[model samples]
Target: MTSFSYGEFAYVYDELMKDVPYDRWVEYAARKLQENGLSAPSILDIGCGTGEVSVRLAKAGYDVTGVDLSDDMLTVAQDKAQGEGVQLSLFQQDMSQLELPSSFDCAVIFCDSLNYLETEDQVKGTFKSVYDHLEPGGLLLFDVHSLYKVNHVFGENTFTYNEEELSYIWSCFQGEHPNSVEHDLTFFVYDERKDAYDRFDELHKQRTYSVDTYKQWLTEAGFSKVETTADFTSDSPTDKAERILFCVQK
Candidate 1:
């Protein structure tokens, strides 16, 4: 029941996720574009948490529009874009139901945001909404946590890490059903400058569906040529893969 409120940790999200190799993912997408002869003047980044990837794409000379449901997260993104002088258009919106001025040339939903949708209707609705907001022949790339990884690695994982100033307790519990994992995350942050301490607890739930189910949903949502791969490379998904990235065309 601990939805992403982002009260105190909103300012620290980018700092924590900076280690994520988002540039690598962008490179993968760019290579896919080059190989497939896909060129888009503009792109819509759905579920763009803090707009890190969108900002990178902007550095590569693309008009990027980042959208997310959290206003706190969007504020951080706006600040970063202003500070870095990146011309990004960020909006507070939901992926399952979006209202935009016009369709985009391409849309990206990265960082496993698709897993945040807890229900089947939400996933199908999001895909259908994306299809409606894309131009013909446009591309859509997204990633999801793999069921295999959820069942094996994250099912019963628990660990603790303590840095010079801050400490954290991270645990994962198997969720109800065929494809779900619950993250029991607790952060004990220390402000060295003020010798103060604060704590934050978050319970995150993520799920993955079969590739066939996703393809069916994409096809029903008007997407054609739905394909999935392991990691960012063009490889088949396996039991040990962390995430399954889906590449679909409008």
Candidate 2:
């Protein structure tokens, strides 16, 4: 299995992502729903890590269901829903082989989680599975790291972040395939009771295809009206854009 499993990372995810603009992601989804004339939508949140966006959407009055491959992540997400006083239907399942009893009006794979699929077939399979779980005319929204970022930006890069209680050294290496990268991350976290720092290491791989390739796969998976944007904007992606967003309708 790929190291994409959250594992120990789940406990510290929100702490590291405290500055993430989850509200903007929710706003983007809401905009798409209104533009498509969808009302009172039921949402399916694929790869809903830690239930942050899931709970946010539920609070926004959408009936929300979340799914993730990591049991640890789902456990945190379930607790988060309870803490927020919102109801969420959550499950543990692989997105590529998703099986759900009910269909949804809209589905989302946000935060560039789709890039975690290492192969073209896996990406297409996930799209197909999502299509099967959606109603006709349903929408699917997702994002991926742009090819430029994968090939030029992340390739052979090193980043470090330091805080009082948590720190990490992140290194990236070029992958065997085009527009792919492997991440090597080591985290040092303060143990309050023991008053010492504990170290944890995690390796993750991510790959992304061209925008045209993504559109083609979505079409092959029975989606129509597939459109794309860049980095949360309504404009097309440019050479420097780091993220690409896709909106597809089934």
For each candidate in the order shown, give its overall lDDT on alpha carbons. Answer: 0.83, 0.91
lDDT of 1 by residue, 92-200 (tens): 9989998988888788899989898888999999999999998888888888888777788787999787776566788999877568988888877777787976677
Q: List the residue pairs that clash in candidate 2.
A: none
Candidate 1 clashing pairs?
A: none
Model 2, span 1-250: residue lDDT tens: 1232367799999988898989988999999999998989999999999999999999999999999998999999999999999999999998999989999999999998898988888899999999999999999998889999999999799999899999989999998788899999888888899998888888889999888899888889999899889989989999889989888999
Give the worst 10-residue stretch by lDDT in candidate 2. Answer: 1-10
List the candidate 1 regions with Cα displacement exceeding 4 Å: 1-4, 192-194
The lDDT of model 1 is 0.83
State candidate 1's TM-score: 0.93
Candidate 2 stretches with Cα past 4 Å from truth are 1-5
Clashes of 2: 0
